[model samples]
Target: MKNNWADAMRKNVHHLAGSLGNLLVESFHYLALFAIGGITAWAAVMAFLGMMEKGNITVDDILLLFIYLELGAMVGIYFKTNHMPVRFLIYVAITALTRLLISDVSHHGPADLGVVYLSGAILLLAFAILVVRYASSRFPSAKVPDPDATVKGALTEEKGET
Candidate 1:
């Protein structure tokens, strides 16, 4: 009974914490929207200046914009789903890693390049799996229930069903 009381108290504390955290986060999101606007304007100005100076846009520099785009997309998805899918995070990480590798590969050789390529391949496979899993869950197909697996008796099978 004492342990049960402790568990109940712990749950109450967590519930209070979650409630307070949600309020604070929502307030911050509203306040931060103004900052986001200013930052986006500054980024656009910088991009325009860089384009004028170079006479052409470098894809390397555009990767920075891509990063910001991913951030905005992530926030957008969060607002839409109240939960962002892990695939977007994986895609963001993959792009960031690729950007880093591309920026630094001037001093790298075949072996180092191979390692980077392998890492990218692994991340790609993981991202693909995540996408497939998400698709399957979102569009579930007809599936038969397992034999002798009732709502409660999932482990213990019926005596004659074996």
Candidate 2:
């Protein structure tokens, strides 16, 4: 009897510890998300302000803003669904590479082969995005049921619907 009691106590303690650890990790996860979202917003605003001050919005500046927009969208989606969309990262990479390629060409007159490499990289990333999309659609994972749908289902059952 003593050994059984001791085993129960140990199991309870282990479960409690696991719960507390999960809580701690979840809290930190949320905090980090908020921080990243806020920082992205701030940087985007600063970039816009800088462009306004210069009174000129170049393609590079626009591309940078697009990058920031993608990042903010990514954070928002992750916050809502707890799932990060890989395509957004790919979009950002494509935008960044395009921006770099433009800057390099404009400054260096396309004399070097960097432009070719950057264009190739952008093409590869674009292909990767397509592949990812195709694979996701082809082998879709189980999806979480919508909470609103669950409530609606309960209401329908209460009304004697089959």
What TM-score does each of the candidates earn?
0.49, 0.82
lDDT of 1 by residue, 16-124 (tens): 8877896898788756754665576677568768777988766566776776677667666766655555666766676776666666664464456566675777578
Task: Identify the runs in model 2 with alpha carbons over 4 angstroms from their true place.
Answer: 142-162
lDDT score at residue 44, model 1, on the 0-100 scale: 57
Question: Model 1 lDDT vs. the true structure?
Answer: 0.68
Which pairs clash (backbone N, Cα, C closer than 3 Å) in model 2? none
List runs of model 1 lying over 4 Å from the truth.
Answer: 1-25, 33-41, 106-162
Q: Predicted candidate 2: what Cα RMSD to the true structure?
A: 5.8
Over 31-132, each residue of candidate 2 has an lDDT whose tens digit, in order, gives: 999999999999999999999999998999999999999999999999998999999999999999999998888877744777778889999999999999
